[model samples]
Target: MLAAIAAVAALIVIGLIIGFVRGRKKQGLPQEPPPPPPEALREDRPKITVDAEPEPTQPLQLEDLVPRPPEAPAAEARVTPPPAPPADLGAFRSGLKSTRGNLISRLAGVFRPGRELDTSILDEVEEVLITADVGVHTAGRILEALRTQMNGGQLSSVDDAWGAIREEARNILASGGQGLAIDQTPTVILVVGVNGVGKTTTIGKLASRFDRQGKTLLLGAGDTFRAAAVTQLEVWGRRVGCEVVKGKDRADPGSVIFDAIEKAKDDGIDIVIADTAGRLHTKVPLMDELKKLGRTVEKALGRPADHVLLVLDATTGQNAIQQAQLFKDALPLSGIVLTKLDGTAKGGVILGIVDQHKVPIEFIGVGEKVEDLKPFSADAFLEALFESPDALDPSEEAATAS
Candidate 1:
């Protein structure tokens, strides 16, 4: 009975083991991780890529390895300086040839190798001075100084006489006051003169000088009576790159100048140069007209014109003194512009003008050239006037000799 019972238990255990194995098969458990999804196993599936580097067609050169310079600009875009113009006239010595020759020759003629100095010698010198247009007053003063020197035994030779005269000229020139007072902004310059005294040319040259100084300038064509005058001033304005304020033909000059000053004030110009009609000082009506213009300038500027420059022809000689005196009486003539000095032997008239009227010579026109119109330098004028031919440059000496 024990043996039979044992056999049945064994059978039950075996049946239990087989039933467990069959239950696992029905669930279908994977043996490893099961093969990947069928879609992932296809040949066209996305894959990671690692590309090889590209090879150059040719070997590199040293220049190719180095960075290249930037390309040059085109020909049309290039900038070049303009060619130079004709040379300018330089030095006062050359310009004073005529005056120097005339005065120096006459003075030199008086001093021969053995000419004795006497009272009659004084008379001859005085005559030469007067003939040179040194006014009676200036010549008298120069002679008086020489006589005092001679009495004091200071003048021993003709050389002493020459020295005395030179000293007197130096004193007279030094007495003239300082140069143009450009102390104010928009320095108003009123240029007045009789007809044909080079007023237009002087104004043009002045504009050139101011332009070179880099100052902003305005020109007033106050000579509205003459259409040519306005046109000429416009030409100068264009050349100097300055603006010109003008009015209709025969417009009131005072109105034109007033407008110019107003414009200059509005534009903040550095200078205002006004051109006045050429009117004779002897004419009462004309003189009154200038006086009215002066009033207009003062009203517009809130002050008197900075410079009332009287332009006179140096060739007018003593007549220039009369003109200067009359103009001084009519207006506050601050300075004088002596033109055509190179064309005349009467440059000595400068001495006379200074003696008669204390107005300083502002500028002197020694030639027709713009550069020839230079600021008056007393020392330079005397030096050039009395400079011996030997002391001058070859060109100046040649000019004087001629």
Candidate 2:
């Protein structure tokens, strides 16, 4: 009887627990919510493009966005500028030819770069330029510049030596070239050289250059003595689509210059390039004429020949040095334009002229075509001089038609 009573008590307790659980569920209490886990979120992002092709809109690719390289500076040298034909190969034409020939020969001979430019080689270079008629002070300056580099333990290989010399020469030449700037209104470029130096040809070519620049110009036949000078300038002017102003062959050069200026002003022309007669050796009368021309133009144009570019024939060798000195002394010569390089052998004389006068070679005439004028680049020139004729700057030919 006692055992049966204990069993009944256990059953009652189990029933009471079951009833409590059912009542909570019915009351709408969240059925024992599950325990939460880890969490995260999501969105969109962009990317950079580098190199993409021109396919309309392929959603610019990353590879298509590289920056473009900058253009090279005008005189930035890859090698050498080509040789120019000698313009005023007057007295030393044969000698100039010889120098140019030697350059060709040396260039053919494995490009010695001049015996490693040892003290001996440098001295030889100095002597070569001096012998070619470069002035003493100018030669000394070049030598000293080289000497300084050597003393400073800078020059070693032939390339380095040449580079050092070239750098110094270029710097000096650059200095002289920079000061004589061109003008905007009635820009005047006075070209003066002794007779038969291709002055007229240069003028024609120069006029053509301005024509391309959209510069309205008038060519003044200041060269009255040469029988064909005025006509030649006229031919070039016609070819280039410009105007020419002339007086009788014996007319005063100063008066001719003034008249040209007056006409240019009246017509609103942009430039007046005067082609002065090829004044020959110590012609005091002609020199006076040039001086008078300068003064008269200053009065009329408000600017004397802004640029007096001296024309030298490379074939003239040492005489080129003398001519440079004469012209430089006679007029405030602005720069030099060398011609006849394509036909002559005395190209080294160019360096001598630079060494002597500190004049930057502004242009070089390489051929007979009107386009054959090129700007000078020291590095390219040196390379050509040291390298083969094949190494000559292509622009030398390119300028032949410009």
Candidate 3:
């Protein structure tokens, strides 16, 4: 067994040596070459030199870094528009529509197309003027002027006759076309009228007119005989941004006016429009009261009332003239405020009142609007009354003709 073990061990050793030799031969046999170095492994490897320094970079500015949008153009200056002219004349013309038809149209008929100026035509003209509430004296004066023009060989054609009449009427109204002279500070205007003659409304409208003119105004509700008069004045005061100085029921009008003037003086008011009891012109007690009220206003201001505007109802015709005369006799009236002029065909009463009383017609209440109480202009009045279609501009004439 020992011998078999030795021989087996020898064979095992020879086999192990042979196996080792075979492994060695296999290892020694040529294999695939080892991979190249890491630098040489890349196909696009760059050649690098170690001597050169890198270039410096610049910092970016706000204007250069990103793309910018284009600039916008400068703005242009703005223009202002012009102011509008006053429309009082146009309003006056519109208000005189009735008068124009009643008086002007009748006069125009007398001087129809080619009618010659004759005494008969003059008589008819006098009748028309009188019928239109132009008082007998005023009509006669106008007729005398017309007859004088005729005697002087000036009134030949119907146009001449119309021109003469207009000239005479204009001359009569021109003197009384003066506006209320409100030159004083806190100008006092004591408005007096008969009952039912729109006395309060006239005061309201007048206040509105003065307010629109940028004048600081105060109203005096001196007509304490009527409670509505006080409230009405208050309403107007609010409407026109004026303060109203009122009295108790049936308070003395003069005392109310005195308080109003004192208040106006204190408040730096530009005007004080005082209302008075609307009394009958012929009523002695009431007229004396108005005279006392006027004196009170004078006493308060240390001067006569700047204006004693007699508010007359134009629709009353010649009765208006009579009323105005009575009021003139009672109070020192500066001017007249003709109300309801739009309601009357007897607007010719304006001519009569001015011609007879010699008192200026300061304002005419043409319509119910506040602005309708226009500052009286004789030229505007005459133009509105007598401006024929032939007086229109060519463009307007063409339009009319068409």
Among the numbered candidates, top lDDT falls to 3
The root-mean-square deviation over C-alpha atoms between each candidate and the true structure, in angstroms, is 23.9, 21.8, 26.4
lDDT of 2 by residue, 56-136 (tens): 344443334645356544423121223334333332333233443454333233225455545766666665555534446
- Candidate 1: residue 377 lDDT (0-100): 80
| Candidate 1 structure quality by residue, lDDT tens digits, 1-402 | 999999999999999989977877788642333344667434455644436533323334344565656644342222222321222124556666666666666676675446776666788789878877787888898899989998888988887788788899888877564666666778999999887888888998787777776678899998888899999988778767788999999999999999999999988898999999986767887788889999999999999999999999988777888888878877999989999887577788888888778888888887765566778888778877877534544443233322
Error of 3 at 318 (Å): 0.7
How far residue 102's Cα lies from its native spot in candidate 2, in Å, is: 2.6
Model 3: number of clashes? Answer: 0
Order the candidate numbers by lDDT, best to worst: 3, 1, 2
lDDT of 3 at 74: 25
At residue 16, what lDDT does model 3 achieve?
Answer: 100
Each model's C-alpha lDDT? 0.78, 0.66, 0.80
TM-score of 2: 0.64
Residue 368 shift from truth in candidate 3, angstroms: 1.3
